[model samples]
Target: MKKSLICALVIYCFSSVAAYAAENPSVKALLSEMSKASQQLNYQLSYIVINRNTIEPLRYSHAVENNVQLAHLVYLSGPMREIIRRGGEVSYIDSSSEPFTIRANYMVAPTIPLLNSNINELSKYYDFVLLGKAREAGATCQVLRVVSKDGMRYSYVLWVDEKTKLPLRADLVDRDGDILEQFRTISLAVGDGVSKALGELQNVQLPQVLSLPQGNLTHTYWKVSWVPNGFKPEELNRYKLSGTNQMVESQLYSDGLFDFSVYVSDRNDQSLKSQLVRQGRRSLQIYVSGKNEVAVIGDIPPETALRIARSVKFSPVAAKKVADSNAVNNSPETDVAPESSSQ
Candidate 1:
């Protein structure tokens, strides 16, 4: 009997250690390493951006030599719109539109942040529990389920390449069980063979980014009346355009794993609004009526978007009714909402 008891204890000890290791692996460390590697290492990626309205396979070639981060994106089929990003600025020369320039952060750059940076804020809205071992990008990886803490943002499943600590694929879903976005690694490389032209931009000067002076924002400006419990804040900044006088109040909120952006404006006479746009895995919704206009942009199920859109209320109304309630943003004024959306 004593022998049997000893064996049971050994098994239990091993199980406990395994459980701890699964949850305690260096997520932050691995992610930091991945970010550093992408910026300092030389590599190339060939992936497909499968959007709802279109599916165009694309390739990105990047090289980081001598402290420069240079990369470009080229579509395989359709009109080839090329974007070259170097250092802190990005220039896009598209076949459809005139070339333009903009300052961008390494996190939410236009092409795709999934490749350029680490999802550091993911833990705020998700429990990054290990789903055990897996294989991806011709290397070992850990399968992690970025489960959502609330309905405001969607859940994500990710395959983090074990060797490189880079995310191989990510799936975006909604509350009613739908995939709003899927970024998979069809092929990836780690070693040399990076071309200098990948980061090369035509020797053309770009206009200085427009500065409206009121572009700076703080947490005080985003006194949200309501947000899902686990939804993390993804971004909050102003969008200032040249040759325009209207200034916008912008905010971004996410649940660590899932994310969304909200824009508030004093109803411009654009003559169009209260609509949503579905771009492949990405989605954009505009809520406009009377003198108020709000735009919620992200990649989540349409129903979730609708719920989030309706849940938004002005600060004035939030103060009047939700003094005692926990959710001042989701007050009674937004009770009636959409039932479904085709997108």
Candidate 2:
């Protein structure tokens, strides 16, 4: 009797565990489905981007042909700007500049991580939660929230179609839960195969691929004293400023979703003072550290940007100089007694 009771208990426990797992699918599973659907499904999405006071309507379409991926995006109400991604190369066409192409895999659209990034990689920095259900873009959707674990990065709320597993709406929110930017789908169309127009786009003569000057692979001389969890240094390089043509040392950092760049330069432009400036959803923080000027720019809150700028710590050689300058500036001056005696 005792043995039979123990066996029954074990079976019940295993059944309960299996039921729970079935009811609650992992966040990674949901994201993986979204990623696969975005790539494999031939769909056209009409959406609008809302950043602060600016509202821009956009159109995006994706298709696969002969194992090659093709995507196109265009600003519906702008100065005539369009992006076409064919396989590994992306072409940009705009009224302000000549058409150009660059080597890239994914389309540079809003909510990039949701559309292209791997869920396993993004899970390192974010904690995903299933936020239940909603109706968006005339479809029943499952809402999911991706929050930064350390509060150093922005969070996102995504509404994905329940049937298609495609994203219908997304919101970029700050630490305080205020929405900074939003992408809302107006309409979406899924087809059995690639559209004829999109297929023909492959035959169009694309612009010559422009070769970007490579940055120096050497490490930077300075590092940040504090960074949010999962944040990692991406690259360190020196590049010339477009306006003044002045060389500047820059370091890039990312947490798989948001990216910020730190630039150190000798040129001190008073116009770019030690203050936070916000344009749309992006923020820029600029300050002077001893003789070098520092700038941090990204699509983050003002506080985050300011904190990153302040946390920058120079190398030992540079640290000493900065410390000495601070000491001299703060030291009280002594009286000139010898000058009085000579007079």
TM-score of each: 0.65, 0.83
Q: How well does model 1 score by local distance difference test?
A: 0.59
Q: Every model's Cα RMSD, please?
A: 9.4, 9.8
Residue-by-residue lDDT tens digits, candidate 2, 1-343: 9999999999999999999778667777988899999988899989998988888899898888889998999899969999999999999899999999999896566633488767888888788999888999999988899987777778889998878889999999888788888999999999955466589889999899889866533444456776666667765665556776454667777776777888776635543557778885688999777766788998767888889888876565543443354356542221211111110
Off by over 4 Å in 2: 1-24, 111-113, 242-245, 267-272, 315-343
Q: Please list the C-alpha lDDT of all candidates, in the order they appear.
A: 0.59, 0.77
lDDT (Cα, 0-100) at 285 in candidate 2: 93
lDDT of 1 by residue, 78-157 (tens): 77577666667767667787776667644233233345544566555555556677786577877766665554456666
**How many residue pairs of model 1 clash at the backbone?**
9
List candidate 1 segments past 4 Å from native: 1-29, 107-113, 116-120, 195-224, 228-295, 300-343
Give model 1's TM-score versus the native structure: 0.65
Q: Tell me model 2's lDDT, rounded to 2 decimals.
A: 0.77
On the 0 to 100 scale, the lDDT of residue 117 in model 2 is 67
- Name the top TM-score candidate: 2
